[model samples]
Target: MSAYTTRQDLPGSLPAAASSALRLGALASDERFEVTVRVRPRAAPPDLAASAATLALKPAQQQQLSREEYAAAFGADPADLAKVADFARHFGLVVLDSSSARRSVFLSGTADQFAAAFGTQIEQVEHAGGVGRAVAAPLSVPSEVGDIVEGVFGLSDAPVARPHLQQLPEAQAAAGASFTPPQLAKLYNFPTGVDGSGQCIAIIELGGGFRTTDISNYFKGLHLPVPKVKSISVDGGKNHPTTANSADGEVMLDIEVAAGVAPKALICVYFAPNTDKGFLDAITAALHDKVNQPSVISISWGAAEKFWTPQALSSYDAAFQSAATLGVTVCCAAGDAGSGDENPDQGQPDGLAHVDFPAASPHVLACGGTRLKANGSSIASETVWNDDPLRSASGGGVSDFFDLPAYQNGAGVPASANPGGRVGRGVPDVAGDADPNTGYQVLVDGRRLVFGGTSAVAPLWAGLVALMNQKLGHHVGFLNPLLYGAAVGSGATHDITVGDIGAYQAGAGWDACTGWGSPNGAKLLQVLGS
Candidate 1:
């Protein structure tokens, strides 16, 4: 018999993929696993309405809290933690670790123990990718702790996201123009005299790894000092570099672009597994890291919103809100798939428009893609990046998950191009060069390569944010509100008015294809500095 006689459903605990996956059979009773339980904040978080008002203010006027202060005010409640521990003990689970700042309690147990504790069965499942474990039913918690537990993760270890990166095909790798990060910075007129000194930029990688030798050689070729890079493991994930064809491209791309543009800033890379639990844990670890204290975070990994669980979406969004209050900026790749956002390589298109999450999260600076033809130091032509509509393009569309934010109210955000035309938040809040034809020249696993995608754009903006912070002597936290407000018409961004990505078209001002267009870094600095 279960320890608790009565249980309540844990809202949003079911995996979205579980519905379609073919269930094989129950897991072995003694199959061991570890899970993370996300709990509610000790106190209610700051009001969104008020936070919007505050974020709209100039950088100096914002009342940002330090990590210590934020933890004290909004971290997990001790009582809530104790209750969860008691519940875990009753079900024969061992408490692994807990963090007040991250509001997470880690536990280790067998399949049978977890099944009894959460009132759900773990089963071997067959999906398109391969066989894995997943929950077949909605998870439930004891009635006493139902409200305190926000999400239960790691019951299913299916892959959650893909790296938003595209390597130029070998056949055409030499056919188009590619610029090094420094050259693009010059073309974009990034602010000079600041090397992101006194700032730390955090990067999150779900897989692959980076070699110091590659980093040293890459920067040496560029004649830039190698930025200090450190890898922090999350959830047992490590810096295990493999071949160039693997996720190494993403890890290398993120590091090279960010460090290339902000050579003096400390780069802290948080490596984790590719599951939803690993993704969320990597993010929270980077945000709450007091030692490194990243002023901005760059995430080049994400999937379409449809692939995520509702609990995962809400939990990740809530973490971004914490970033805003702590004065840390988060830059996420808007995705490589176009408005449809379906994985063409895996199967046929779903024939419906979709947007990517983390980028779709209202709090993040969603970085989009553009194709640029530069005339020496100046941009001759720039437009929406859409080499292949179904397979590769700058991802943009109205989000089905999040409502329109106040800052985007006047940006002429359109309804979802899909049926029912639901109104929601638009993606790709900003843009950068991201076409494989005009991609960034990078070093991956000691091999020179050209990589593109909104993947590169996230780090591009992250490096720019670090430079901006160094120049302004403050973190330009939560830039979307200000970008839509004071920075409009300020010549801070070059408005791309050409090209289209299937469901959306590029326009003079804010459009779904490339919101407010690509950056003019010097002007952006002046706008934020003021």
Candidate 2:
């Protein structure tokens, strides 16, 4: 379902800045040729079939690794092997597995390397049937360029399992959620005096089509000011709606939430096909939008950590930085998988470590998941929220490949104590409601689906940031360095003190489950307001 375009003329590196002319996502100034690589699936064994998390090969497969026949050929485990496996698994490659071998792997390095890995000859690389160039950065933060940032703190006090979102009575439910109580409402010192009139937020999506009719209906129900929304395109062209998922719902929720919090802001939605090429192109196009140029951009779609190459990661960091330069804050989903995505690429679950990306990249703010306990209509509490194990949970952990950026020098994130010696990056700097069961209700075309995922967290937080921007009349560009410093102890954030996300247990102060807990809307306004 994806294509890889090969570039023979260019080096095996992506540009710190883009030069492609053919735009797919919307930001392309040049038309670039891409080779298309069709994504296909392979079979895996029974026990190993759905279980994508087996660390060493399965007992039966030991011969495959031990035999000099295979080991010698593949090398002492290809250096890139770890990277490739990590990348593939992160992208749900395993889910595509049949009932035989393992999943097919997609290699992003040199052709010879891919051919060796897949045991195939290099035909033309496939290009994502896309139309936009992937933008790298919006602001250039040379100093923070090389380091991995710190993120995600846990809250152990919110309800882990709760009631159904669909069955909730329409009369009791309000257009949007509100926080009132001890922690969340307290720290969420929302700057009541703030207004987002001069600000704009950009939403990037694939596969979901949202209609103006739905928008009118939604706001009318909420009784909020009808937002000024503009649609842009890349390959797909102009105003349109694609498909729906937690990611799409989350994007819409954030837009509405931000508008609700800061009514004066304008919203721009950039819809692209949800392919790699389309994803990249959409972002590029969104960046180029001169009219409604977003002061903030929120992306909720991505694969596992290693799916992207260093060049790709760098490109994204650069893109976010570019946005930072423009006073834009980029927020991303940490992932629905737990500490490690249980063999995300494979269908069967395993207890291994996996992280979601571009969230893992030091540049963007990684958003996590949480559950809120409320009475009548007010948020009673918010805590680290997640589904049962091997199911889905907020993604939080340390990175293996990246070194801690200097900005992380004193942040509480410890040097990862894992076998992988690299300084790790803590995911999900901040979190919001991502529990699918207790998910948000949204409008797509005409119907409403209550969906949730880490996908929802990113945009929700981004919208909050927009509201904050409206309040301060200033953008909080690249907030990691500031948020992670000592803000955890500050009342700026509500300490979600309940519940647990499968793997990690939430507790008193910052835990891995719910990072620094959920926001206290009114309080957040006050803190940011000041």
Candidate 3:
């Protein structure tokens, strides 16, 4: 076999039409660019899907393994990484850092050096966010190095996912009876006695920051313990809050909700830039963080599947798969828009139903939204979230990229949609209270704000998973198989049999709008504990 292989074709997300030259004027040859080389795993567990399914039915203890054990079983080969580093040095690039598992090799060099090394143009591209630099074409490397480099990220610094948090206006009439986090937990029958002690919930953020004082004051008012929060920066991103945007709403809401539900659980927030490199790096850092060793991670940011390249999707999904092997549960918000998931301003269609990525990825739990009404702690009624005229609702639909996983084989996932004959993965796997009319109250940068989106649902489920891990005495890694299995027919979840989000309607068993429905905490704990 030839020692080299060409890089895979770039996704449609980075179209040829995006080739307008950046306005930065003549590029300096000495200007350096940082890039991450993703190395392919030496060997993938051939039966990984089956193994995850089996483990989902068994206790967490049965499949749990230490970081060292996981790395030995599935990380990239050391020899392959050495070849990549040598190639970087051969082209006068500096090898900044290489992960212990050799999965990610970070390198830096001038645009001249990179252009010479990869045989690609180094230029900035114009995007909706602003002009950012990127490789104008597919990168090619020496045969020896190309054989192992799965993909090269950070080459094109395009804007990443947007926070799914939606701020509701102050004047909107309070529809459902408002409830604090604790009160909401009670209404859902969350297990008592386990306050998520001894567990760390990792929260991934692309932008925004959280203030300690706000977290302290809010929790104090509720008479709950102020959860310990830690910040870990990735890819040069920081925890800076600016007055220009409401992005901070996402940062604070994630922490407040998870902490409120699991007061004693340590919360570690990983802050990164809003770019493809930053997003993927943040997730990889969180998944492999030995210091935090979070058993559960909550991500409230995502873009529609159509916006991601095939290469980007595969790389990101691989990270989630690795998390499953390490016994970590990841919860991602489906999206805030209805089935279309379109951004008219971005030239995307308004009528086509598209699901969000990460959420749409079968490995992570795709959490949708719902409007819940309660009469003094007893559930009054709940329905799929659809606040029409306003044009906001929970995101649910079949994916155009991924196929249905084995776990969803017979859970009533449909095989057709508005873009008929397109059979793919159905999101979400579960849902939570996310309607702005029935939204969670959060304090962002000192302002009391009401926000709703599938965003809040991710952290809500993360807290529940943290509590379950604490109660069960182990982590519950990948949840879909179990969710589609034993946890389905059992009394663990509430089936939302009302309303429609757009292309899909809520029904008895499973539907795109609500998945297997929202969590019924107490019953869920009992079933999973056994």
Tens digits of lDDT, candidate 2, 1-530: 22222212111122222232343232222222221111111111122111223222212221212112222332222333333344334332332211101111222333333222222332221133222223222211111111211100000011111111111233433544533111222234445555567888887766444567777887777666677877777545345455553233444555555555555678887866554444555665565456675767877766555444444454455445444334457888777767765433344443546566667767677788886655654555666666644446777767754555544544455444346544566665678776655556666556565556666667667667776766666666556554554344656566666765554556666555556666655554454444
Best by TM-score: 1
Candidate 2 C-alpha error for residue 153, in Å: 34
**What's the best-to-worst order under lDDT?**
1, 3, 2
TM-score for every candidate vs. truth?
A: 0.97, 0.64, 0.93
Off by over 4 Å in 1: 1-3, 16-20, 47-52, 127-130
Candidate 1 has an lDDT of: 0.90
- Per-model CA lDDT versus the true structure: 0.90, 0.50, 0.81
Tens-digit lDDT track for model 3 on 1-530?
A: 33334443323324323333455543467888788888888788332344435535644544666777767877878877788888888788999988745388889998888777777777755765787776666767776675677777776777768887777786762443455788778888899999999999999998888888889998998999999999999988888776414678899889999999999999999998887778888999998888889999999999888677666787888888888778888999998888887655446464667898879887899999999999887789999998861257898889888887777887888765764667778899999998888888887777777888889999999999998899888887778877787787887899999999877888899899989999999888887777
**Global lDDT of model 3:** 0.81
Residue by residue across 333-374, what tens digits does model 1's lDDT show? 998988887768955667889898889998899999999999
Q: Give the TM-score of candidate 3.
A: 0.93
lDDT of 2 at 404: 57
Please list the Cα RMSD from the true structure of every candidate, rounded to 1 decimal place.
1.7, 17.3, 2.8
lDDT of 3 at 312: 74
Higher-TM-score candidate of 1 and 2: 1
